[model samples]
Target: MRIPIGRFTVPPEQPVVEEKTPSPSDKEAGVVSEQHPSDHESDNDAISSDAQAGVKKIEATTKVWSKSHLIAAYIGIWIIYFVDAMQQGTGTLLTPYVTSSFQEHSLTATTSVFSSLIGGISKLTLAKILDIWGRPQGYMITVLLMTVGLIMMAACQNVQTYAAAQVFYWVGYNGISYTLSVFIADTSSLKNRGFMLAFVSSPYIATVWITGPMAQSLLQGIGFRWGFGIFSIITPIMCLPLFFLFTYNYQKAKKQGLVVIEKSGRTFWQSVVHYFWEFDVICLILLSGGFALFLLPFSIYSYQAYGWRDPLTICLIIFGGLLLIGAFVWEAYFAPVQFLPWSLLRDRTVMGACCLAAILFVEYYIWNSYFTSWLQVVLNLNVTQTGYVSNIYSIGSCFFSFFVGIAIRWTGRFKWIAVYFGVPLTILSIGLLIHFRQPDTHLGYIIMCEIFYAFAGGALVICEQIAVMAAAAHQHVAVVLAMEGMFSSVGGAIGSSIAAGIWTGVFPVKLAEYLPAESQGDLASIYGDINVQLSYPIGSPTRTAIMDAYGEAQKWMLVGATAITGLAIICVVAWRDIKVKDFKQVKGLVA
Candidate 1:
């Protein structure tokens, strides 16, 4: 006797007994056959053939709509990028003015802390929301949060309110960016994903140039309120098309039975409970609180009376560390549904890509935290000049990202690019930056360093994204990418905190050491006021001393950045050379 096993028919030893007979209802529902044994074998063969035909029909329908919907989705994505670039560029250029208005130079680091904390939490939250609820809902919530933040900032009368508003804005900004990346991953094959990401991001290059100058003019002319207010309106309008596109496609998918609506005959409260279980809300709270408590102390310690030795700081760090440990244990062994997929830990490529992203960001933000202020004080560049010089990085990022996208599309390889171009150029650029930190360094040299650093950094971004996506299973793409973003955000926060700590710890002391004894009393006043530091005449002893202190502090920061970039090279080297191919093919093999 022969028994069917998938496509093959296997011969069994001895006579095969007939299984239990189907009831009348089973026959009516087409679940089981009520026929002679020989007839039942033919019926089973026909059923299998019908199922295969149905699968092919569904695939044909999916291919047809996938192409059309993808084109519409890409158009919506481009519009979102245009609005996002304008908002980011304007906010970045206006940072100095915002901090100065609050009479705290260290507000730069403080704001970064706020952004990182909120951004990290938001990414973790939105990852679950996106994977569970779908992209359209996640996108709508992100835009709504950002709009509210912008409105609050525009209406803010105090520094407290402004800082509070930034929480919402950063969360929204990070969520929107992460959602867009997931969208690209969902629509494009691995072969073209890098190109698609770069193509969408290319708009930012042009937008940055315009918005940087525009932000300066807005701050100098109309004011910060109008700058924030105008974007609040533009963001929602630009994002509307995306909302419509996603909703339309989602409904269409449901109608086609491409998506099955999981229905549970549960009450509203039970539904909420189900969602909480699925999203692992407890783990999210523990993780977010733990990170905020531990990391935020570094940013604020310099302002405390006892600094790092403060009792409050000590308690925060201790409790935060404990909570983080608890969260890890829960996710690893106890949770029924784990948030962090521990299985990915065994995959060298995924972990390597994530670490590469995190380490590189840490390196970049070390010098980045104070580079603007360094230019103003040490190099004597005005706001407009500083904006132009600082924005050279964006110029480099824009062009290189576009070209790298094309390169990946053409060459079909990204690992060697990371090893040969991305890692080396970043190391070289940071080294040059350290060498050029002196007050007498030429403006051209600084600009060259910015260009080289940003261009190389752009290549790394493209490469890491491709590497991670290639290594992850298709269904897990969104969460895996979110994990990469989460690590990078945490790194940025840590880097900013470390940079602030070093600057605050060193700058005032260096200023005191460099200044004449008689003028040392003015140290507190100078730290409090940017204008006061700029008040001294050219080549004056006071101005020279301030510049010297800035140069020294920045040199240490760049040195730290250089070391981190070297570590990033090790991460790039350790990354597995996973070949980029269509995930559909990978899925086929697994199936």
Candidate 2:
């Protein structure tokens, strides 16, 4: 019907033309009524369908890398891990040799402090590097640093040189590990990520058994130089394939216009300035330095003339505490980019996972720091025997970690495994170890404790990784993972320091009390030289006294670890149950 308009003519209403449905023959000829009431709605429907199809096409293009590429990438990362495991296995055995060569038993604790501090710092640094420059660049830099560090260690002639070499090696080791973790997170779907990570760690199984015997042979027969030198060459070779694969894929993506590399269009110096600001170097310094200075005193107190009363120690503690406070403030309020995002603290899953990891490492290191020496002194085992015994824990860890990965994939739940299996088994193992930590305890019982502890500990590791990743946004995975690593490293440092303090303080005093009057004056020599202690005849009073003293110290350490493990169970229970989503689902949601 026609109606009167503001300025035009008013016309009488005419009979309305009703639209008729098209016949089948007319529909086949693409006929449509011009007067259809829903003409605009039909056009909108067609546009919506086209848009949905376009999204699907884009997703398919973005996910173009083949399964074979993923498999090759996994293998390449596994090779890097294998090399790292070899270093770890041999490094444990090298401690005594390094100490003896330097004529200082305290070097052991000092080196650990340096390694942990550098390693923690490297994790934070590498996280930024990977996020900014991409994974291939980060991986290459880590391998290069590690190779250089190994060469330095192989050629070192003094404790100072060895300590410096350790700094380099540990930093690179942490970087490599962190980068590989991020790569796994990027490639695997949430449901299968646990298994992929565990598979990467499978190198620990073979390296644990082989590196021990190899370390023993090298240290006893030839020397530590070759031990360090051989792996230096192997690491770079293993890393090459992964580097190439990443570069190839990145370039391919760029060529396809699927990814854009952002340029700041600044001069070289300006770019450097931007990168420094982007990496938040000031916060990095504050955090890393604070941790190092504060924790270093624990390792060095025994060597100080005044122990904890030393002015230097007091200064370090105060300064470190202040720097840590500053770091928190800057991260929370000032830094453009935070090394630790305050936002993550709001996530119960991230916090719980981080806490669980920190607690576990603290307990693990408390016993680990002195375990080999304890085995040697209390059990009268040689290097090879000690390696074999110590590695039982690792053997169990490898087997159980792999099993937990499969279970998580099957059940699609990680928290239950941690609560039901990890916590109780770990606590039980520690309790048994504490109970049996006596001079006359059976070796079989000790081995059993290690086996049980490792099995549960391995599962806990898997749980933490899965939990943290599951809770994080895909873009923040690297940073969150690195944050977890930093916490765990800090925990290791704290545990090592405490263990050092206890062992160094108590063992010397106990040894002095138990030694015969005639031999009492040689406490310094006895403490410095494991070989000198072993020279005492078997079953002699001197040997028995030293063994008893070690037993006492080890018992206390186990007690501390047991208490920490109990607390970790609380964290395990508190972790949130977040469902893992498949890659396609995540992508769709993001789109």
TM-score each candidate: 0.85, 0.86
* Candidate 2 residue 240 C-alpha distance from true site, Å: 1.3
Model 1, residue 367: distance off in Å is 0.6
Off by over 4 Å in 1: 1-69, 260-262, 516-521, 581-591
| lDDT per model vs. reference | 0.71, 0.72
lDDT per residue for candidate 2 within 1-591, as digits (tens), equals 111111112222221111111111111111112221222233221111111121222222224455566667777788888888888788788877777677776456667775776687668678666655566777889889888889988999988888889888877887788888887776666677777777888788787677768877997788998888988998888888888887776566446544433444577776666667767789988987898888888777777889999998899899989999998899778877566666765677778888888888788888788788778878888887888888887777877887887788788778998999999999999888887877899999998888888899889999998887776554456767887898788888788887887788778879989988878877788788776777787698888888888887788888999898888877878777655533221221111
Candidate 1, 94-195: lDDT as tens digits: 766676677776667667765676676567568666654566668789999899989988888766777778878988888898988877775565667777
Candidate 1, number of clashes: 0
lDDT of 2 at 216: 77
| Clashes per candidate (backbone, < 3 Å) | 0, 0
Error of 1 at 543 (Å): 2.4
Q: What is the Cα-based lDDT of residue 522 in candidate 2?
A: 78
